[model samples]
Target: MKRTRVALALAPFVLLTGCGGLSGGPPSAAPGTNAPPTVPRTATVTVTVSPSTPSASASPGSPGESKLGPPTSTREVTVRRTTDNPPLVLGVRFAKHDGFDRVVIDLSGGRPGYSAHWVPKLVQDGSGDPIDAPGGAYLQVTVTPANAHGETGSPTWVGGPVFHAGLGNVRSVVKTGDFEAVVGVGIVLDHRAAFRILEQRDPQRLVVDVAH
Candidate 1:
């Protein structure tokens, strides 16, 4: 009876040791044995992309925007600005584009009035002499209330009288005249085609694009 009572007293201490350590952490690895490391569990995320469409307001071909086909005329293109201290013509330049030929006229002082149309022939202002510009058809771009000089009478046009564009449609461009308050730029093309005009600001310039 005395031995049985002693055994019962030590039973609680033996139960605690059989369970894990008191701190409740993972058990230590066996001595001198290779143990594997514990790696954290993670989730993999995936993302999908979608294509964007053109906006409703963006059309196929518009002024200043290029496209695959020829230009379409929006009625008769004309801008008339009458001023006494008119815009001065700086220079004339041209280049060949994807579906058209471009001609640019640089200007300053102010925005000037302009008239572009198919003319039978181009004539020199004041002198009335006929111009023998290259190409078969003539498209005359006339800027009114404009000058090729400033108040000091210094010529603003550095390279003029004529320029050979040599594009798909346009053959050349010529400064037919700079008389009175008007300045003329004649576009010589292989034949008449649909053309468009654009008026740009900031520095103020006139652009003409002929369909190829």
Candidate 2:
């Protein structure tokens, strides 16, 4: 399909520019119910999750998947201008792509500023406690000017706390934090390799692809 999205170009896996932190998620619309039917989900594949992921975060992108460039080690982040509404994290999903594993963070309202980097291990945001994310390497992603819950303290995210991707490289994606306007996503990978992040409009979403 014809896709219209901006490429957050960087040195391979490195970010093109730096950004600030802390923001909430998308709208009040129920998860999956209002999300655009853009990315397709491919389910006929291998599954290695220990307990199995109970969230749509492990599902594949629908049809009309955008053409993101090859994953690179220098890639790091992508930023979206913040809005008064800030967005609500509608859902998180992942799928095994041709040469990498893909992670999609669905959002609403207006896309917000976000950043990510490689961390030695996963940890809770406020408490700083180490998270038991299954994998050999860890990637720390923070979505800011956003929220995973609505104003009434009701959760807007459509998944559980931690979900396993079980792709060739990505093992799982964990929600490490949701304090204030920031929502953290911890991705566990089998090994360290180049990856890139992009912001796609039309049912706004954040896409991360890690090399296999």
Candidate 3:
């Protein structure tokens, strides 16, 4: 009876004492006091510039001029048909704009000698004038935040072609194709540009300028 009583008293002590060394060895060093909350990382962007070239000399389409001022009003652009067989253009998408806007084309199937030049009045200016870029084999898009389909601000041209600070919204120009080529202008101001050519299965995507 005495032994049983002694065991009962020591049993609690032993169990409590062993908790620290039981299933595992001695407890690990108290985890370094909780670390301070971590901070999120942010991306840093860089800007580079190149010499300015004659806006008219590149190709030809819209008149070369500054349309940076505020828009007097708003207007929509009309869809035009191309001569390519099987209709190379599947769909044309444009970004939302307050001053100048952009139209993007989704190709159904790429053609060798695909080229883009401004035709007739697709849209109008803020003053309600018919917009035209009639020149050369290529179409010259008069890039201004307010004039280009109600899009606001200038384009940041980047990548190998060139970036001219004098031209506010203009960013980069890219040409793609082995036998035949097409020129593309990257209007995305937030991204930087990169280009790559793939063989066989992978689709060859020519990124004019990506957001930085």
Q: Count the backbone clashes (under 3 Å) in each candidate.
A: 0, 31, 27
User: Which 10 consecutive residues of model 2 have the lowest summed lDDT?
Assistant: 17-26
Worst 10 residues of 3 by lDDT: 13-22
* lDDT, candidates in the order shown: 0.65, 0.68, 0.22
> Poorest 10 consecutive residues of model 1 by lDDT?
12-21
Q: How do the residues 72-111 of candidate 1 rate in per-residue lDDT, one tens digit apiece? A: 4312234454554577899988888888888888988655
lDDT value, residue 23 of candidate 2? 16
Q: What is the TM-score of each candidate against the true structure?
A: 0.65, 0.67, 0.18
- Winner by lDDT between candidate 2 and candidate 1: 2
List model 3 lDDT by residue over 1-212, tens digit each: 35544434432111110111112222234467766434322111121212231111112232221222222211111112122322122222333233333334333222211212223322332343432322222222221111111123222221322222211222322211111112233232222111111111122111111111
